[model samples]
Target: MNITIKGKVPPKAIIGVVILVIALALFLLKEPEKDDLIEISESDSIIDEKLEEGDLETTPVIQETIVVELAGEVNNPSVYILTKGSRVYEAIELAGGLTEEADTRNTNLAAILQDEMKIYIPSKEEVKAMEEQSGTKAGSDYIGGNTTANSSNQNKNSKVNLNTANSIQLQQLRGVGPSTAEKIIEYRNKHGRFNKIEDIMNVSGIGEKTFENLKNFITVE
Candidate 1:
């Protein structure tokens, strides 16, 4: 008997269509989920923000102003520029350390420094005299008997005027200390105006040597 042809497709074509459907189903299932992808991106964004904040905190900051001075027996005594909070040691190091002759024993390397302070390194004679004074050693002229010599020197120079002297004017003279300064003021109160610089000879304790020292450092006019 002859078989009638049916409307169904061929076996090879059916197989091909089935295979295509399976491939499409797999593609749809394997595609990334939008919510999952969004969650991952959100986690990455959080990490980025945290890292940014951390980086900001770790950044170094610089200070605007810093100044320091080194003086006294240093190879080169000078003021130096520094970053804020830099220590005295740093400045000393910059100046090439202390000279071989510098007396470092009395110096405090760790001392915090200020601007424009005079750091004096005393000479050997000066140091010895200071020590003698402190110990009150016999035969040491720690009381400064040199005042007599100073008096004699002052007498040789032009005289000073006590009554008319302004502090500015008075300080210009050598051998004038606070005590002498006060004396001049007192003399001014007792006496009227000074007739001339020569009138200073009348003041007690002033002499020729002191006047000579004052010559360069003072002015009569």
Candidate 2:
């Protein structure tokens, strides 16, 4: 008995079927790689955004301060830091306040403080010694920025301190009467402080000639 074929198959049809199978296999294999690339690109985009946000910096804030030193006749004398425009009495209070031997009459507690200022709280005996040595009455006034551990804080070489002087202290000046003293105080109050001794000329009626005469006998300190 001889073998018999069921049907005739075309070479082109077989070739076409082979090509379709190869194409289907390639498409299936490439799908995972395409999904992986998409996920990696999305991950890279997120990482780049985080890096850009991390590159930006935040600004810092700064605050002004005043450093002063309080010594002599205070309970606890040391350097202290305070806000700008802090007064002398506030510094003294930070230093634990004045002791019993402290001569309050010679210290200007109400004066506004300046940076790097050194305050010396003089004793009563020290004030007397200063008065005896200077051959004059020297008390009830002391301007900012002084240093001398164990001496009077109000001498200013027996000259009046124009900055911290009260009405009575100002009257002790050669030509300053009560009205001028009030004007000086008013000027200081209106402004802030006498940065220099010549700033007194800015006051009403205290002219250049008056300043020349008062120069050697007064100071802003």
TM-score result, candidate 1? 0.36
lDDT of each: 0.50, 0.73
lDDT of 1 by residue, 1-221 (tens): 99998898789999999999999999999999999999999999999998978755555686665555555555777767766555456677876676665544433455444443233332344334333432121111111011111121233344333433433235435677656765554454345344656556567777777656654544334
CA deviation > 4 Å runs, candidate 1: 1-60, 84-86, 123-126, 133-221
lDDT of 2 at 39: 98
Best by TM-score: 2
Q: What is the TM-score of each predicted model, taking all chains together?
A: 0.36, 0.49
Error of 1 at 79 (Å): 1.2
